[model samples]
Target: MRVIAAKEFSDRIRNRWVLAVAAVFAVFALAISYFGGAQQGAVGVQGMEVTIASLVSLVIYLIPLIALMLGFDAVVGERERGSLDLLLSMPLTRFELLLGKFLGLSAALAASTLAGFGLAGAMLVMQWPEGSLWHYAGFMLSALLMGMAFLSMAVAVSVVVADRARASGLAIALWFFFVLVYDLTLLGILVVSEGRLDLDFFPLLLLANPADVFRILNIFSLEEVKTLYGLATVIPEAYTSPWLLAGIMVLWMILPLSLAAWKFK
Candidate 1:
């Protein structure tokens, strides 16, 4: 597992995938943080809450797509290349191999996210000394967890699908559902129900998607800015705790990967 993990990480580093992703994230983070309020005829570091809110929107759209694209081919590509059998013939279980692949890819994604966002955060902090340091750190961590959860789902798709083409399609479909369609669908339901449905139960539907969990985690942490943010505005009091939402995020990380491992075996 260690050997496989190291090779996977080193391969990403060698191919400059890490650098490319980090550059993309850093560019977007800086751009959003600095120019997000341009429509209001202002430019520069806004308040920490504002900057983080902007970046959260950016991450919700970008990170899951990147993570899914990155790992969608992990297992299927190996199978297509006829290397999966050879690897399985080695002294390792399928689960171990999958674990290594996930860990290595996850590390690459995490490093890129931190480096990119951390750079933007540092710049903002320098400009706005009053910003909450831990708040930005939490935002970055939640972003990383969201990336990992999607990556896990991508790997699961890689294992279940017959080829790379199907994996790619399924991964994108998952992204569209979770990032774009899920909330809209829920809102549609609410509209159709016309307040007849119990509103308090709405937050439960959010747990099914890691992205929604992330929104809740970050938005609620910045309590003062919750109503002013996008995506998730009114989480139930029970679901507002960051730790509980984070635990759900962890479950999101595990369940898909666990399914993949089961299918792989």
Candidate 2:
């Protein structure tokens, strides 16, 4: 297991794709922060906050995109290249192979996310002395878990689908549906239903969407606007507590990884 994981980890670190994706995230993070920081205002803050928020919102989509790019070929690519037969002939079991690939790919995602956002967080803190470091850290952490969930989703899809192109396409389509269309669909339902539904039902509905949960958790930092997006203007701040939000975020990470593991096995 260790040897397989090590080999997979080394392969990922040595791959050009990992470096390219990391570069893209780094450039976007720095460029947005630099331009957004120079124009600091409530408008600027909202703009800057939105810029970061946009990245968080896209975490689900982006992570799976990277994962499929990296791993849609994990088994099938090797098979097509005529390497899988040799790999299977080795002492390593299929479970070890799948797990090692998953872990190594996960590590790649984590490293890329951390490096890009870590640099961006440092730049933002330096550029704007008044900004909240804690808030930035909290959001970065939330984005990491969101990324993991998407990576797991991609892995599960890759394992289930035999054709590499189909697996990649399915992974991307799932991401698009969840990120772009899911919220719009939910809002449509809410609009048609009116305010008849209880406020408590929102959290239950939110469980269906890791992205929305992520949005609410990150946006909670904007205390000034919390009332506007709050459960209700009459409700106390405690009604939208951060710890509860974090718990929901944790569940998103665990559930997807479990499904992936089961599928792969």
Q: Give one digit per residue, the lDDT tens place, for model 2 in 1-265.
A: 6776677667777876557667777776666554554655433333445556555645556665665566666666666678878988899877777777767777777777777777767766665436667777777777766666666666667667777788778877877776888877767777887977665555567656666666676766766445555533533355356677677666665665566567655
Instruction: State the lDDT of candidate 1 residue by residue for 1-265, as single tens digits.
Output: 9888888889899999999999988898788887988999998768788888888888999999999998999999999999999999999999999989999999999889999888877887776656478899999999999999999999999999999999999999999999999999998998999989987778889877899888888888786678776434446678777788888888988999999999998
Angstrom error of the Cα, residue 152, model 1: value is: 0.5
Q: Alpha-carbon error at 212 in model 1, in Å? A: 0.8
* Number of colliding residue pairs in model 2: 0
- Give stretches of model 2 more than 4 Å off: 37-51, 57-61, 79-82, 224-257
Worst 10 residues of 1 by lDDT: 227-236
TM-score of every prediction relative to native: 0.96, 0.79
Residue 13 lDDT in model 1? 90
Question: What's the C-alpha lDDT at position 192 in model 2?
Answer: 82
Query: Model 1, clash count?
Result: 0
lDDT at 233, model 2: 51
